[model samples]
Target: MAGPILTAGDLAVRLEQGTVAVLDATVNLGRPAHDGDHTSSSGRPGWEQAHIPGSHHVDLLHDLTDPAALYHFARPSPEALTAHLANLGIHDGTSVVTYDRSGGIWASRLWWLLDWIGIEAAVLDGGFAAWEAAGLPVSVLTPDSVTEIPAPALAACGQPASVDNVRAGRWVERADLERWLRDEAEATVLCALNPEAYAGEVPTRYARRGHIPGTGNLPARSLLAPDGRFRPLDDLRADLAGLLADPAPIWVYCGGGISAATLGLALTALGRDDVALYDGSLEEWSADGSLPIERGRADAGR
Candidate 1:
């Protein structure tokens, strides 16, 4: 019962209990340099320089994604994710808290993965910045400084005994969106990318610009405060008013699956558990010339 989100102070207390496993899911993308693409690099260097005590770096770029996936950050198979978590010393009943150096989107991506597989995990509010702002301890110890934690032998250790069933309930595919477009399914699809990308107003790394046709724009960054922490629940509820009022199930997506996960975490925190994320997102959708895409504002006609 830890959280879908945790404050630095709360995580600090949890760390003291010696049962918490902290993972730094940092992946630097389009920052300190804007390449106008989804290209990214590992945040391991940042984590090695300074991190929360006893924390381990989980490279989202390599460790948690599908190696053979055509798009970046595709959700790894359940067996793969289970092994990864176990290697991080996570198992049943292990309280996990994830954080990152940039905007907390990466952390939320891992949190979303855990939530998908029925494991309880939380994102650190404000991420590393908040921890440092609170004058909490930081460490320069590399991941190599600590002994590798062996994966546990339990059949249901860090993942559900039935991982396949749990994963099926949380994700949507490109075909599902196609069905929605054709009116075969009832769902509200929202793009979690920024306004520029959503509108095809800027150059992008994807095969094409704009977004999946008929999807509304809900920039994921809008959900965060200036300091990078998620805004208050009441404020979020206000922004999500229309979607919440709608009876249809919600589906969210982004450039890849990274930023969308931020929306996913926020929605879950607001008690809207019916949300599903499109892992392929624009990376998959835009590549297919056969699929329809929309440019400009969804409500411009209004």
Candidate 2:
């Protein structure tokens, strides 16, 4: 079962409630440094300087990713994640708020990833900018005596669905995926992309370009409302349920296969099974030129 999306108006109702954890999930890809200083706050540091009175830091690139494979997917280690949540006093029943500055695009990743890991969480509508516009309370002092507790059980990578698992059922290679979507493969279901990165063609940057051939272009943003919250379950069901009804496994993708994890999370929230995200995505496929890439409506880069 899923919970309601908590907007600023709703969060205002529980400004200082019990056992609520606010997470600053600010993640900005490598940008030119304004100065020669490497010690400067990478996003999480700003949270320390000033953030929601009791907000905790959840660095998307660091805390949520695995060091061993960080260079590869830049994802966090399972142990590191379990410990990170514990430090924030997060547990099975803790209420969670995850947010970032990117119009809920990246924020959606944290929101859904937590769900994959079995935590009940949601994104703060409109992020910190919205919070500031509404005059919410913020402080520079870090939380005191934050406790970290290991999970009774840990699943590496936030329990994100594996590429192997998604290959089953209605999924196909680029050409097949296109045929399925184009009425060529008999699949009239809805589709999703792994992340924003693969929506455009970056041939040399990735193993391939574009998404599964016939799949509908349901960008991760499709599941979210303009307020930066997930749409109502009924609405999600109406749109996504049709895609799954055709019995063709709904396929998802992105560059390195990380965003696909986020897409699978949405499917879980909607209670839709029979769906899979191609973890290899374009990155793995493009590694070899023999693989083909198709340009659909999704190929138009943002």
Candidate 3:
């Protein structure tokens, strides 16, 4: 994989030279739920209000996801993703940069998706916050309308069966997770929720509280510094020391699936290719009463 991260200054230079495709992959994770509306939220409105100049908006919830999936943040089929990418002017030769306002959480989500499909992409280290802090330019200008490709026209793109295999390698299903819980599989589970959520002190959108059994609390925010940039590589390694010492495959999960990707990106940057994301995450895991959820921070010691 190419370098997984880029500095704001480097991206600015690329943007000025028109050598790279920039995307504002920002999603407002904290959007208030509307009464009787359970659908996922988006950050496009915020992007329309203010964004990096020349950056196109990618709605992770609507544009890049499988709308038919039972849960939000589900991965889209490769053909669907390819069409979406082509519509956004991203293709085989395009070098892509992704960033978000909430640190790099949402940006990493798109980065991971692009990576799975063999596209060269990177996340802005500190995201929009860092860019603005450096006095970089911002724009309220909407992107030029690209011709929408009909679903039939997309069929010629050739769908590959390998897409499912690629997704299988990057994500873990609930059935596989159950096997792991029964000691039938070998993997280390990591909870990417905030300390409050992990401890069961804060209410979450999930059906239940707390985390899965035998998982460690490594909040996604801990991977980043106060200034929003990711911590130094050595420091990141230290923060995840427990998982690093274990040879078991590392599996990360969060409330929906957004924050887990942040952890996935961080692990990937450390040169660990054995990491996987629980795409359904707590959203699916907690909804089923059959699965056990442990409360408090006691289980975090593992």
**Highest TM-score among the candidates is held by which one?**
1
lDDT per residue as tens, model 2, 145-201: 442222221212333222222123423355654455456654333335533333443
Better candidate by TM-score, 2 or 3: 3
User: Each prediction's Cα lDDT score?
Assistant: 0.82, 0.54, 0.79
Per-residue accuracy of model 1 over 1-302 as CA lDDT, tens digit each: 44599999998887776656788999988731232366789998888899998888898898899999999999999878877777666765666788999999999999998877777789999999999999999988654787323223222365433455355558999889888888999988889888887898888778888988888888889999999999998988987787777788889999888899998899889888888999999989888888888788764111
Compute each candidate's TM-score over C-alphas: 0.91, 0.64, 0.87
Q: How does candidate 3 score on lDDT?
A: 0.79
Off by over 4 Å in 3: 31-40, 142-168, 298-302
Candidate 3 residue pairs that clash: none
Clash count for each candidate, listed in order shown? 0, 24, 0
Off by over 4 Å in 2: 1-4, 30-42, 70-77, 141-208, 223-241, 244-249, 256-280, 288-290, 298-302
Model 1, position 266, has a per-residue lDDT of 91
Arrange candidates by lDDT, descending. Answer: 1, 3, 2
Inter-residue clash pairs, candidate 1: none
